[model samples]
Target: MTGRSQTEDLARLFAPYESLAATLLGRWDGSIAEGDGSHDRSHLMRVWQLVRRIARGEPAADMEVLVVATLFHDCVAVEKNSPQRAMASRLSADVARRLLDGIGWQPARIEAVAHAIEAHSFSAGIAPRSTEAAILRDADRLDALGALGIARVFYIAGRLGTQLYDPDDPMAERRPLDDRRFALDHFETKLFLLSAGLVTPTGQEIGRQRTALMRAFVEDFGEEIAMPEDLALAD
Candidate 1:
């Protein structure tokens, strides 16, 4: 099959699975907190879209595993700093396995899906052993870096009553970077570094673009907040 035809075929095969996963997650209709807007069904679908795009560049990636993993990656949604956060991926993976079994997915495919889901979380500290797992991990992380990522940082902070920044040191230059205390600190501590660790070439390219956009925003923000004397002194 020509490359275009193969991609079209793959998309057709995964479309139903994506719909089923979305339907299942929609029923949950839950969030981590009352005001939490990130990590919802919308987030899942966005990551799934990324998975499809990234998978296109990775011929070795298992589309089935990637689709199932992406859908369930955040199905269990724990707070970022919760003690249970590290295990959230595993819990989601277990739930995914059960769901896949109910749909008559073969044990091997189910296992592949579970493993991909389990290894997709940044907090899980598990290296992806398969291309599908790597794609899922990269896709999910991609969603946490660009314009949407900036909004999510502030959204979660607002939900937790955290400050937008430390006026004296927005970049946390002298103090430790505490994203929990200041939303802007997240750019320094995590967002800027994601591009380096992205597993797939396609993901890395997208990560670079998003990271650049975020960096520009931070620079502009710092300039906007600088005291007139500070700008004059630099001049």
Candidate 2:
């Protein structure tokens, strides 16, 4: 058998982990509660779904590990639009270990999952280890694209209440954005950076399409702002 099939067979052994993972994810009351737009369960589920689809093409990827890692990746995200990248990475590793233990995953497998979760943070600056890790990383980044990303930006901005860009307002005086700065700045801050970091072929393709869509959206948004009379995508 090819290595891909072998990995698939191995994953079958972990078929019983879904419930355990869902239970653990339900406990993630971090940023979502306070309305931080960074990462939430809805976001987590979307990434989890994307990772699963990627694994279908690259069966060598471990579904169980990626599922668990993605679900728990941002369990400790910044508190409502803060830059808590380091803390999120650290907390995800700890939480992944605990959840994996409760599910009785092998010690080695648990450690691998923990390592992948901790290192998957973009700011953590660690390269991916397993295909599972790469998939998880790509999937996480994918969540920051297209319409979902737009909603996230405004949702976060509203919570933080940051203002839009201002040629006159001092840059240093701006608070971390809540809603206003999000529309103007998302293109540069996060959305524009995702396509390059995507790892899987399937993910990269989707990222490309989403990037095009987002760029168009941003350009049009700019026009709408310049005139405030031509709201094309308002519907």
- Candidate 2 per-residue lDDT, tens place, 1-235, comes to 1244433442333345655544554444333212343564456557767877777878787766776777667766555445665667777788778767876789998988887787777777778878888888777777778777767666666666665544332222355532335455656666788798888898899899888888887777665555233543462
Regions more than 4 Å wrong, model 2: 1-17, 22-38, 80-83, 167-183, 227-235
Highest TM-score: give the candidate number.
1
Cα lDDT listed for each candidate? 0.78, 0.66
TM-score against truth, every candidate: 0.83, 0.74
- Candidate 1 lDDT over 1-235, as tens digits, reads 1244433433344485746544444433333112346876467558878998998899988776777677667667688868898999999888888778877889998989888988888888898888888899898899998899888888888887889999878877798998888989989888898788898999999999999999999999898887799776886
Worst 10 residues of 1 by lDDT: 26-35
Q: Which candidate is the best by lDDT?
A: 1
* Model 1: per-residue Cα lDDT at residue 172: 75
The alpha-carbon RMSD values of the candidates against the true structure, listed in the order shown, are: 7.1, 8.9
lDDT score, candidate 1: 0.78
In model 1, what lDDT does residue 118 have? 88
Error of 1 at 185 (Å): 0.6
